[model samples]
Target: MTLRPLLDPQLIYLEPAVRAYARGREILARFPQARQVEIDSHWRNPELYRAAAAAEDWLKLKRDVLVLGVKKGMTLRPNGRSADFIAPSSSNGCAMACSYCYVPRRKGYANPVSVFVNVDDIVRSLERHAARLGPKTEPNTVDPAAWVYDLGENGDLSVDATISRNVEDLVAAFRAIPNAKASFATKWVNRDLLAYEPQGRTRVRFSLMPAEMAKVVDIRTSPMAERIAAVNDFVAAGYEVHVNFSPVIVHEGWEAEWRRLFQEIDDVLTPAAKAQLKCEVIMLTHNEALHDVNLAWHPKGEDELWRPDLQERKVSEGGMVNLRYKVAWKRRWLDQLLGWMAQTMPYCTVRYAF
Candidate 1:
């Protein structure tokens, strides 16, 4: 049976500059039934944003709207943990509505998938940046062989694949760049990506959490088991695979749940996948604004995320008022979780953890 379309857009906000691009045109053809509106800028849709922000149905906009625009500034920024650098986005926003997601914090109320149709320019910008870096002379936490560039900082590429060829194009582009590799974290499992032929030049970090906990927070994403089950296949398909224990929500029995999660990963991954496996652990960092937003749409998640008793306020480097597990508790949790990972999946090196 054919699965229904993941995104059946009812309206497309198109930027005139990108209307003629092959990617923009393809997206238009894909959603021929959707109403189209020409907008001056994707970022300046005041009326739509205002209406969506006022409504409780933020997800309704995510489900029914799409945006196509040219990515104006293609600047690469330094990142030391999950990747060496954050590349210009191939797309922004996401269809899967993870309640703790940081993307929607800046995007106001509705955070639908916005495809930057000028993919060739984004790829060219990467090529230029990588050429300037030349070759990696030293190994870093991100990679031992190449400069790892994060391609999906704002969206899930696996979900992005369903909308356009952007992910495939970037994967193919990196296949030839010997000194730079592309990486992205995703909670969704789009097997369509397996055919992209990354040739070890792309790393797919499967974002994971305890199965039951995931249901509470990871809205509309692939089940944890499906992401775990795809590990070996992704490895066999010539892409490096990793796990992201991200936004590691600390609730009652979270330690036990995480231990069980690690054991499952060890049990299911093939020897080859384990050999190449590494992981990054990021404890939950919740924003007050996002907490308010979640309450409106997914209050149940706030039970797992927003904790006044256990969490303390900390301003992020980006200047957002964020809540983090209190220092002593976070330290203890990180150490305990690392210990569990060591005992359960020793072969999976922790590239970074916090």
Candidate 2:
């Protein structure tokens, strides 16, 4: 499939001041030529849309940021499981334009790739946040004095080799904070990570798919076998590795395909590796703006009827659509998979997004 340019909604530039000795200052200096061009309003640009469709040399240079914070004047959730902060930190702000990607529809940016030169600042921000959380004195609970940070929620860390190097920097900073841990998730097969020694505070999670399904759905990404091999390498290096079998598309012969995939994992992964593994099966959900866009991408009858409750709405003046599967259907598959894992590897902890 041909790639398309993204329709950006807004364009903003951020240049934060830094102290001379601050590690973030060095990172910020690397991006002396960097810029943040928000695509939150790009759907209104007809000319940009046309250009995105026709240009092969079109390179978008901008950083995308999504920020979410706890609601004010409210206590933490009664269940105490919800995160206080959730955001996406893009090492490379643009994507590789996979057909299954929902980024273009949601953000309206046409360019699918842009590498960030200033990831040091991003790592410093994470360290600063974690430091505020205090040092860990007890297990299974954040020390009243430790800060907890989650990295790479916005985009893949390995999108660029230089950006992936920041993972080590992040690990170093977090190690200073006695109770802090950082999480990074990626689909890229980063061999460099296997070669470098991590500080043991960073948790690496690989978003994976079966080989056949990856061929069909994961364009511009490493093949499944290579990714699995990388996973094995990371496991051997003593890193805490988690596997996310996310957005489990329910296509024809899905059950058999998943069974084969699990079998491969069971056969190759070491017992200690399996014991350290955390598996999560995610159900797809999109904002309202993505519904019609996705429907246009895939006609109603062309794809499986995965979700019936999908709806259409305009995010701005530009029309867009979002889709979601029924919650009950998602839970059913999650339960079944967890049950299978329980039988196959009872020591592993399997999780699901409901």
Candidate 3:
């Protein structure tokens, strides 16, 4: 068996001068055969460029293609509950084949890591944005000392770190700014990242699910044991290690599954990690399109995830259809999980549960 890099992009594309940059060169060195592609714009009129890649190769393209270009739009939007502000995107798409991931919805059949090479612009955006907020005058669950910026909303930096210095440079950028902390969630464990001292200016939230459910859906991501075990190590290093009980999947024997999962955390978590442990609980919200997509690539997972009777349809502002547990089922389910959490992991504080 071949040991693949945490992020193994079979083909890499850099936009002219973007390949000459330090971080760009770092990424190129890791994948020697990565070829460069030329496009007049990073975000527009690139259909001809994309048409070169075959539709049958979508999943392979998702896990394999890497685009390095400028992030021209530097606007930061308000992301209140998750973070003080949504930091300008560092990258888009992920390599992991998590069947339940929402990223594939927007990308249709093809989804791949698009690494932004204009890192200095991204850092500058964060610096300017953080400066405008000044001090966080009020209290919020996101962070008490520093305004939190969600850095990896669309991609996994843990996997991204293996391919480029984009994640590292962003973490370093956040570390220098006193008024904000860089926050991102990951399903993979990159222990090499511990070397970067966040200086209490970054938060690494490990997204989790029971091992049984994850094995069915998480695809090539790090093992649940690896993620749980890394918490103590990350805390021992300068990073604030947090847990994300995210995209919570409810199915047969869910209670027993969750109980065992929480108990495992309770058993292995070091005291230092426990003391600072804060969590954000997000319930699973599935979508019809994503369910259909999963059916094609990972049908086994869809058997557990696509439960029509338990879910209710929701229409987002973008006119996309999403499904969450019906209100009645959700109320009962949340109460049940909360009880289990309290009983199994008393030391952890749930900053927010939704």
Candidate 4:
């Protein structure tokens, strides 16, 4: 694969508290050419936040800005389906601009990748948390042998690996944890992570969609074909690989397109990958705030996302008003998609669906 810079920030927002950290110093040395601004707090950088919204091009701002801070609070929350718990974020935001991304909603106008420098602290806390949970006493769909942790709850670890050692550190930390596994969903195909040597301690869920839909919705992330092609290789590299059919967009002809996508996966995956493959199927859920944001930066992409006729209003657990496919319709669409998957890739297991 041809080498390309994973990140090229024109401006670096530095949190003074983190500059003394080894990780922070390494990042500064890596990007000496970029303009650096000292900020009081990573989350409270109003100037950068406003600039992100006011910028003429949203995607450009995402590519040009970076935030570095120390994650002071290390709390792992319960997560039943994707993992046993949502691990403390090693990072937040993402370089990729997927249209339906929820990360940007909380940050208002801007959502550039935020790298947390206190990774050693985060890892130590995770070890303590895992020790408290002890070994798994019951088998569940998430993992039969260990408690699972979603290490990239708010960001893409594969993309984060490009700019920081957090992914490497977290994966390495999990290797020694006897009863816990780290997992994250990502759209990027970063071969650098193949050297992390997870030894089945990390689960990398490659988020996927139909090729045509992905071309518009995934935005700046790896092409659908590349993600599919990398699955067997990642599995070979000792990481458990899973597929995520996330934010499954509902539209006319979506089923036929999905069928083609399933066929492509069945044709490309090696027997080894197919044997271990498990999937999480999540239908599209859109927020009004995100819809308004997309209109500013990527209006055309919204055409595939902001469909209200087939959707109904939803109040998210966080109390945000959102839109999702009505229950009856979503069930029907899910059933149809799963039926096709069973026929095309019977070996693949559906770990969870929503």
Candidate 5:
């Protein structure tokens, strides 16, 4: 998540309403060189990514290609993975260059963030959905207090917060609603979030891995140490802080790296932070298409990610064919990691692991 403040982006394409909205105008002004273009809509357009370009070039140019439009679709989708529901998108893409990211799979060439300006409508939609639930009657693993809504399903809110106010706006909206809470995970550390007093309604999951693994794939994101270091401050900021040991890569020396990572996490946590911390373990889910994209500039990651002998093709709930480590392999890895957590990081709660 690269949220460079003063560096102006080179280009921006704005749709009709987007060119008029306050948020769009704010973003345009930040990038002095950005040019506004008229697009019919952000989601339906195919020429942006399909027509022409190299995947490697996109790694550098995608950050410069910003799309401003309204999110016309307001219906929230059921998501049992982390949150109860996936909130309407605050943003569609990320600025980071993580090679294994699935967001790049569908975008053939261009894959920059499509920042929606109509946040009010998005919030209203969430309001409507939460009203129907009528205060958690049935309890589930997601939460016992209120229904959880994911605000950053498609984009990193930490990076989006720097370029837009939608992240905080959603947090504020969820804070006021008695029946809901906002949740999102981040690979970047946004110091700006410390200003918001969310009343413990916003849960920030800090995604982590060993420094060596991050150095290989999690490109342009905040350093692993910085992410862990922010844990204390984030908890102090009235946010439910959680750890997401995500995209856990399997490689030659992964066990040693994970051992060191767990030890480091144990070393850094105070009783205050550790008492509040919960974790979600996500094993690496790799796609063949993304592997091809990573080979263009970041082949080193694919060397470890694309292991056919250990992996098998499976269609996701979204129906995009993807690869994951075979069942036996995943079980073994998850058991090993969870065992490590039990011994070294006993204070942390493993909410879910896969």
Candidate 6:
């Protein structure tokens, strides 16, 4: 598909000037003939105000209909340890522009978070596939009893600025699928979800980082405190809650920071809530290290971590270098993190991402 540069306003500077420029009105005027317009939430960064303004300009031009799309292929792909399926959501517009965002490097810098207005087509495709699989039977099972689907496996789900607009549609679509379990993974704390009754098999998974790390690297995202509080709210509403500490960036005092963060999570969870918590501690895998410097956080000697077995792929922005951990190191790290979790919250079950 041919993608056009709708606009290129400087995100950092233009955000404050949005009202002054009548950006929304300008967008409405410019793309009047366009079928749909998508405003990426990532551009909301004050540092990227110019970009945001450009996006806002386009959004205003067209009162586009928004539709959530689903990946027709296998949703679950292997990450570290657990496999995850792609749920129905926007492409991949993450609000937090971390220095080490893997999406740009591994998947390219395209606005994956843009709403797929062809969502109805996507659902129809899924229904067709299900019908082709044949009727459910004990000897030859085609229609599985439980289908687990994860949202935003390629990006964050509840990036407040975008989710508010798209979540209701996502909830409605997934609820229509029988025996389907949908999970949304996000770094932001979305309390609004608590208000909606659990529809379909939807679950909210939160990807948390240390408060200090989040402050330093997770630019433009919600704070750790808010995320923890939101998770508690989800749990109280009787929703399944999963915790992911993926790409666990190692910095000085990381251990202590992680310990404190987990403790905070434990403090808020009720006994039953704690039992339902599925926690995963994932270290940085090579697949996600492609756009290492976009957020400006790569180390000086990062090449040392590269391995020959890892695949190298060239993405839209630049080259991506991936590396897998040595078997021994993987086991060692998993042991250390799981051991810590056991000591801190013996009741919670912890899983390591391979």
What are the lDDT figures for the candidates, one per model?
0.90, 0.51, 0.81, 0.90, 0.83, 0.51
User: TM-score of the candidate numbered 5?
Assistant: 0.94
lDDT of 5: 0.83
lDDT of 2 by residue, 121-208 (tens): 5555555655655555554322133333555544566654443245566566656656665566678776776655555566677877
TM-score of each: 0.97, 0.68, 0.93, 0.97, 0.94, 0.65
Report the Cα RMSD per candidate.
Answer: 1.4, 7.5, 2.3, 1.6, 2.4, 9.7
Q: For residues 1-354, could you state the per-residue lDDT of candidate 3 as single tens digits? A: 986564566666667777667777777787786665666654443552364245355456666677777787888878777677888887877878787788767665455777887788899989988898898888887887789999988888888787777788888998789888999999989987998888778899999889989989888889999999999999898899889887788888988889999999999999899999988888888888777766656789887778888899999888889988898889789888988999978878888888
Can you tell me which runs of candidate 3 are displaced by over 4 Å? 43-59
Candidate 3 lands at a TM-score of 0.93
- Window of ten residues with lowest summed lDDT in model 1: 51-60
lDDT of 6 by residue, 241-269 (tens): 77777667544466798788779878877
Residue pairs that clash (backbone atoms under 3 angstroms), model 3: none
**Per-residue lDDT for 268 in model 5?**
88
What is the C-alpha lDDT profile of model 4 across 1-354, one tens digit per residue?
975465688799988987789999998888888899998898888887778776376777778889999998988899999999999998898888898998888887588999999999999999999999898999999999999999998889998998878899999999999999999999999999999999999999999999989888888899999999999999999999999999899888988999999999999999989989999999999998888878887888889899888889988888888999999888998998899899998998899999
Total backbone collisions, model 3 = 0
In candidate 1, list every pair of residues with a backbone clash.
none
lDDT of 5 by residue, 151-251 (tens): 98888999888787888888898788998999999998999999888889999999999999999889888899999989989998899899899899888
lDDT comparison, 4 vs 5, better candidate:
4
Worst 10 residues of 3 by lDDT: 44-53
